[model samples]
Target: MEQLKLAARNARKKTIVPVKQVRIGEGFVVIAGPCSVESEEQMLITARMVKEAGADMLRGGAFKPRTSPYAFQGLGLEGLKILEKAGRETGLPVVTEVVDPRDVTWVCEFADVLQIGTRNMQNFALLKEVGKANKPVLLKRGMYSSLKEWLYSIEYILNAGNPHVILCERGIRTFETYTRNTLDISAVPAMKELTHLPIIVDPSHATGRVSMIESMSLAAVSAGADGLLVEVHFKPEIALSDKDQQLNPRQFKQMMWKLRKLVQFHQQLAKQKSPRGET
Candidate 1:
């Protein structure tokens, strides 16, 4: 069971978008962009394509956390500048990760929604920084963190000041070697019961395969996720980060079509299930 104290704490606070901008009750929100900001052209190309696919928001990592020091880290402030430019051009809200607590101010200046990536879920200091930002925040579960700890992390943000925090189940580390991480579909309904915060799923990172995005996304919405955070690239094979999980423009468009239909059906079902004039 989740700690009700934190849940209650989150309930009384206000959100950045009034629960209507990012997404509505069980309304599917599609957030897509490159896994990491590579260059000006790369970011704009992906953002334009995703916007054309009807994505509700655009996501990209400006300060990526790489396991290997030699791997390409994000473009830092330059990457953020690219994302901002894309958002301006496409009219899609920008979402990106903030790896360090000190960069909170810089990120808030560009990103519409501040993302606390899975690697930074336990960064209490960073969480506090986002908690105080005026923008809405997207918080991902750590690869090794528990559900309880996940909620507590949310508390860390809520207690700090900000309340427009969205939970994202990006998958967790496990013994299985077949996939990058174990996508915890159960976290969807479990989180719903534990808190009113809107929840989203990241199928790209969860399965670490482009082919699995459609099915996992469908399952996520079916499981009651409020939105999806997908990684889209003009050419996934050459993406700077998480190339294996990135979706090409064509694949992303197809998934978006299916998601639109599913969201409509789910909304109809919800209306029918509710008591007359209750919802």
Candidate 2:
């Protein structure tokens, strides 16, 4: 845990990770986009939609890691190019997952924030590669990983000299089969107490149902999450991946409206709290 000294929370301050021009810990950021970049039009359309709905950043997978080999494995470098174009056209910083260590530099060239997916959460080589790069990293918690293990993984990045790291609690595997993964809403405040890194929640992957995302997202904010990573698609019915959990444009906007209020309330509550971790 000592290795994570820079990321650990203290009585004085919280770590603020900056990506592009957006200050993550300073405000409640909403990062929304499709699960995968299916086409140039898909990327641009969703990017515009999310941005119009007040999303702070755009998220799309260029190199998707799937359970089945026959599934849509993303559009690779072409997808990255389209994501970059969409970000430029919309003026939103883009975030994409980088699974392999070899693609770090290429992904960094286009992505404002490099994401380490759940499957690659403990990929030490990939973590080290991204840690060495000069970009913010969004490290998601592995489905099977414990909270302590998650902190140690962050240590790997902070120890490697990159201070810009964001902790994303995307849910963990539990006995429940009703959702893709159990939404660990408690992890939000727990992590806040354990580490200074800004923490965000991924309700899209947590519940794996459109109807549950809104509730879980609100719960996350109430639990002290710094932001959210949501999946939004123009037409989720025909999405390439994670269609069931991806919120359509309308749903996303509605959720954003609700989230804005929740964020304000959270900030107000924070202002009333004492500096010594007291309310």
Candidate 3:
């Protein structure tokens, strides 16, 4: 818990991030969308599906950070406009990644939640920049980072002033090749004990297989995670980024059907524990 003044453990209280009508830590909030905003039509279709399926927020990458330099690096400002319009039409809050410290300010104009991807989890400058913004931030765990390191990075944001922060475990790098990365399910409950922040899992990135998403998502929810960050494209097969990991909107709708029931059960259970349950 080194230098964890803001993100440190606090069993008596928890942080609740508000995204419009949805309160993230207060309940099971699902944010689903394409990995990147490919086109206006693509975004509109995807956003509508997720919203109709009961997702609380719409997530799309406007500034994708790719491993290859020559890959489709995202449509930048154009992508943001598409995402913003889709979110507006659907009435779902928008969440998009902010890669550079310079983009934090302008990105906020379009994004309700500014996401710090796994690749930039330790980007201190970007963290601080978002911390100063008016919007909440979704910070992902680095592929090679430990839980302690992740918390410290959160401090950089919290220390900058914004308390509306959410944690996402997209899995960690491991020797396994079958999946994109090894999902650390334990991190869900582990975060509950170590910090007051709400944590969600990204099964799409963690397992990197369409077959594994539903199961891992169920496991994450059952493990006491606050919510999930899922990748849902209208047609993942035609996606410009993370094609293998993205699920189609129809698949996401089906998954949402199950998740809604499970989440409702969890809500009822929480209500039973406390009449004024806000956790």
Candidate 4:
């Protein structure tokens, strides 16, 4: 019996260690911004609007990976500089995706979090490079990868001496014509059970339709997502990339209002269910 108790205590310690000490959303963190940093003016305007809408962090792509070589490849360092300026002005942490291992240092210098995009989830060298940096990282699940593969990709970061990691569910590729990608909602609950890391859902990328973002985002919260990462643009139709997934200012504000109500309700319910005689 004593031996069994000792084993159980050790297991508990391991679980407890991983659960705490990670920088994450306190309630429901909202990360929002444009799909790409078109110019200084565009990034600044969107940053201010998202901050006004109660977003916790801002997201923009400094280096875009396009399927076609002729497509726009983002503004690179200039965009990061613009993002840094916006972060300074708005007091919100900035998150930007890095596509190359060589740019890790420069990217980490400005952005609060380095996003490992879906296409680069399996980029072991790049993952190792970011892992060595002092900044936090957001790892997005690959469109065709399994949940196990996704979590193990996180292991690459944690093992490289950084514990500040976040998991993003950005949907997976499927044959459905109705949506851009099929959302794996069950992954939220499953991840909660398997890991202590915070999980944020990207309904924007999952559905690829602004009209569907609100519904999918609400559903993610219902399934216990820790936060949301959405694309917010002042103008969507003329945006450089992924215009279909971007939300205008008015729509984002509405979603934030509804999310606030849901968060409050959940907090109250949690309070009411406290264990007997517990604080």
lDDT of 4 by residue, 1-279 (tens): 222222122333222212112246457788999999999898999999999999888999989988898899999999999999998898888899999999999998899889999999999999899989888888999999998778778878887887777889999998896999999999888877667677889999999999999999898888888889999998888899999999999999999999988888888888786789886
lDDT of 1 at 88: 88
Work out the TM-score per prediction. 0.92, 0.95, 0.95, 0.90
**Lowest-scoring 10 consecutive residues by lDDT in candidate 1?**
11-20
Native-to-model Cα distance after best TM-score fit, residue 26 in candidate 4, in Å: 2.4
Tens digit of per-residue lDDT, candidate 3, span 116-169: 999999988898899899999999999999999999988999999998899999
Q: For residues 1-279, could you state the per-residue lDDT of candidate 1 as single tens digits?
A: 435465443555422243335553346778899999999989899999999999988998889899999999999999999999998898888989988889998898998989998988999999899999988888999999998889888988988889688889999999998889999999989887777788889999999988888999999989988889999998889888899999999999999899989988988897776778787
Cα shift from native, residue 70, model 4 (Å): 1.1
Order of candidates by lDDT, top first?
Answer: 2, 3, 1, 4
1 versus 3: better TM-score goes to: 3
The C-alpha RMSD of each candidate to the native structure, in angstroms, is: 3.2, 2.4, 3.4, 5.1
In model 4, where do residues sit more than 4 Å from their true spots?
A: 1-25, 274-279
- Candidate 2 per-residue C-alpha lDDT over 1-279 given as tens digits, one digit per residue, 9 for 90 to 100: 655676677663788888878999988889999999999999999999999999999999999999999999999999999999999999999999999999999998998999999998899999899989889999999999999989988988988889999999998999999999998888888898898889999999999999999999999888878899999999999998998999999999999999999888877876785779654
